[model samples]
Target: MSIKKCRQEFEKIFKKYPDKTQALLPCLYVAQEKCGCLTEEIVSFLAQRLDLPKVEVYSVITFYSMFSFEKKGKFVIRICMSLPCYLRGSREILEAVVEEALCIKPNQSTEAKKFTIEPVSCLGLCDIAPAMMINKKIYGNLTPQKAREIIRRYKQEKDK
Candidate 1:
């Protein structure tokens, strides 16, 4: 479907919320779901549809790390790097997973076009330290081997 079609669907979601501000998150989510990332064009389109200033939309997008202006890989891998995860050898796990799956450093995508590896601040799963998110699903209590296995499984599922 085209971005215009996505925007029309987003308009329906926006209509459900009593306030335009309340629709921001869902609207952005729909935008990302349709376009894979929030680019300048999408942001401008949102601002126009929501009747908000472009700067307002841009500020909101910039303030949130969850929003991406650039195109992401098919899989967006977020490895937790907060205190608990740090103490739990998250770095090693991150390295192993990235090397094995994407063959690139953190914040890089593989040449094979399969995955992107990134170090995230926290996933609010500190209790499970060394957690990571694949797309939106959280994986906790990760070891280097577990990370590799998870990536393999995800790739297999995506292939299917």
Candidate 2:
């Protein structure tokens, strides 16, 4: 993810769409992919590059869960709160994450910035139910004890 690569990608996005507005999402993705998080600096750069209003960029990023305006923890824990997962004890799993273990709440990172808990719409693992994903690795069929144990293991990991 280099600046040169982002410029190239932006050029392609601009060429593909007749309307500059149409290139916003792709340009945002390209910039975010290169910059890690879409901070104010990156957002400004993207706005100027894409010929968009800064507010428009901000609005779009805020609306999309996929975009991040600030840096997240090394490990992002996404707990599914979908109806299926909720019915199967996802609430207990969330409580286990918040009150029982890590004091951090949803969308907040630990002090060390090691883990961030994000309550997401779904993980598409309804069959397993009560599922959570740490980074890209999925954990499912969880009880509170199981959830605590999994968190402990991640906490002990030397190389995140």
**Candidate 1 structure quality by residue, lDDT tens digits, 72-116:** 778889998888899999998888887776578887766655677
Q: How does model 1 score by TM-score?
A: 0.86
Q: What is the lDDT of candidate 1?
A: 0.81
- Assess the local accuracy of residue 7 in candidate 2 as a C-alpha lDDT between 0 and 100: 74
Model 2 regions lying over 4 Å from their true place: 1-36
lDDT of 2 by residue, 69-141 (tens): 7667777888899999999999899989877778889889888778888888888899999999987799999
Give the Å error, residue 41, model 2: 1.9
Worst 10 residues of 2 by lDDT: 1-10
Q: What are the Cα lDDT values of the candidates?
A: 0.81, 0.82
Error of 1 at 26 (Å): 1.2
Error of 2 at 24 (Å): 4.1
**Pairs with steric clashes in candidate 2:** none
Relative to the true structure, candidate 1 has a C-alpha RMSD (angstroms) of 2.1
